[model samples]
Target: MLGRRAFLKLFGGSLFGLMALGGYAFGYEPVIRLDVTRYALTPPGWTPGLKLRIVALADFHACEPWMSAERIGSICAHANGLGGDIIVLLGDYTSGTDLITGKVGHRAWAEQLATLRAPLGVHAIVGNHDWWHDAAAQRSGRGPTFSHRALSGVGIEVYSNRSVRLEKDGHGFWLAGIEDQLALRRSIRWKRPFTQGLEDIGGTLAQITDDAPVILLAHEPDVFPAVPSRVSLTLSGHTHGGQVRIFGWSPYSPSRYGDRYVYGHIVEEDRHIIVSGGLGCSIMPVRFGVPPEIVVIDVG
Candidate 1:
């Protein structure tokens, strides 16, 4: 049997530990930690002798005191130093949670992102929050959402069910980006039954005119299983590695498939997907176990 003094000490210690963990999650991980995660792979049908380095940033829920324009600029500068052949922005540029002290303007972040430098240029795709938070687009069930317009206004091409071809050292491949899979809410009043998606996977793939290998940029990893083998690789964010993970398991994942598509490299049926643990928080401003990351992929 435990003594009264021992029980009291144990309870106090546990409370202190919990408070300390909460402080780290709220103050340190999301605000100050930035990790550079790297992966290298040669997809099943990639062109021979062709090497591509891709630097990707995702889910910048831009807000004051969290993801400010100056912070974004610093991140962009770091990415530029990486010497990527191409850079991809993986969406959710707007504030994802209402816990922000102040919202970041679209143009402010866009202007900072414009500083990003890559030989093949910068490309972008929209995320669910980009559509859900846009009042005009949500009301109308369509977009040129603010995120899309802001990115395009800054000279970065934002793809919506679009494909473009790029070459490196004479080897050509198609880069495709589809619209967000959860672009709109079925009911703003109830916010349930989110059945609508702006994505057109088949339509996007159809635009690829050649047999050259393809890289697909999707905002959510849920689309990976449905991705055809024709696409050599699919890159995604939006899960943020469940925002709080423990021992490679996330207790609360926003993904319908849960931890299966939550983070890192996933392979199925000769197809590959890399899901980034994105920068910034959503639903709440807290992070633990999974730190903010800039993903770098070397593909052949």
Candidate 2:
């Protein structure tokens, strides 16, 4: 088996060099975003006068052959194609272990993928990669990926354990983004006071009106099982439907969480979870049983 880096060099060269001849000639790269616009939710005692559509893309890893600027643009175009009102991105911007090499690829690709345009607005939280040097090391020798500034430029809100309110038609909802518990490695040093649980973020959620429906976005599904039952819905990505599935099942997913939340919609009573296949690839560039996905959720 070839090393991941070596494979990327070969794959990226093929992808970029083939550009002059027109689009790459390997396969039918698509601009497909799963249309879940019909996904409906009715909070108790809530009148249905409003509709909300969100585009959720996650685990970018931003690798060479899998996550090219061209491909991401395809996904973005697909998202815009949705007549939906709002768009949200989960996380994981790039995939690399070496900071220097990773950042170079991230900067180059990030510059290109920044063209996403959405109507209600785009929001995101960092994935393990975006934090685990899941990004560029130092273009000029800088830092890791979590950025309110850089992502904001692309119209994606980068949130870490934060919340915001959206209201219309005399009804309202609260959206909260919590820090990734799975992404605990990078945050160890700075966490002086030492907090053990995600409850630290409950204060942010408190800002919302108590009766309003609330939605949460956390990158890793590992975070979902722990979310308080109070949260109405949670959105996530990072598994990539095991990135490579055998036959049709994700042979690679090892968590006890099961395939219940693998890819697509999972509804349990009032608790709903959406795990997107995302627009990029990681760990390995090739995909089987899973095409990269952009998930749209219509919550009213």
Top lDDT model: 1
Clashes of 2: 7
**Mind giving the per-residue lDDT tens digits that candidate 1 earns over 181-261?**
999888856564665898999999999988999999999999998999999999999999999999988998888898899
Q: Cα deviation in Å at residue 110, candidate 1?
A: 0.8
- TM-score for each of the candidates: 0.96, 0.72
Q: For residues 1-300, could you state the per-residue lDDT of candidate 2 as single tens digits?
A: 989999999999888876632331113221232333335565443436766677676766655454556666666777777765667778777663231222335555555557666655677776666655533431222233444345766555767677888765566777788765554343434542332323235665766666666778877776666566577778888777776666768877624577766766676665677777765556545455566676767666
lDDT of each: 0.93, 0.61
Candidate 1 pairs with clashing backbones: none
- Assess candidate 1 and give its lDDT: 0.93
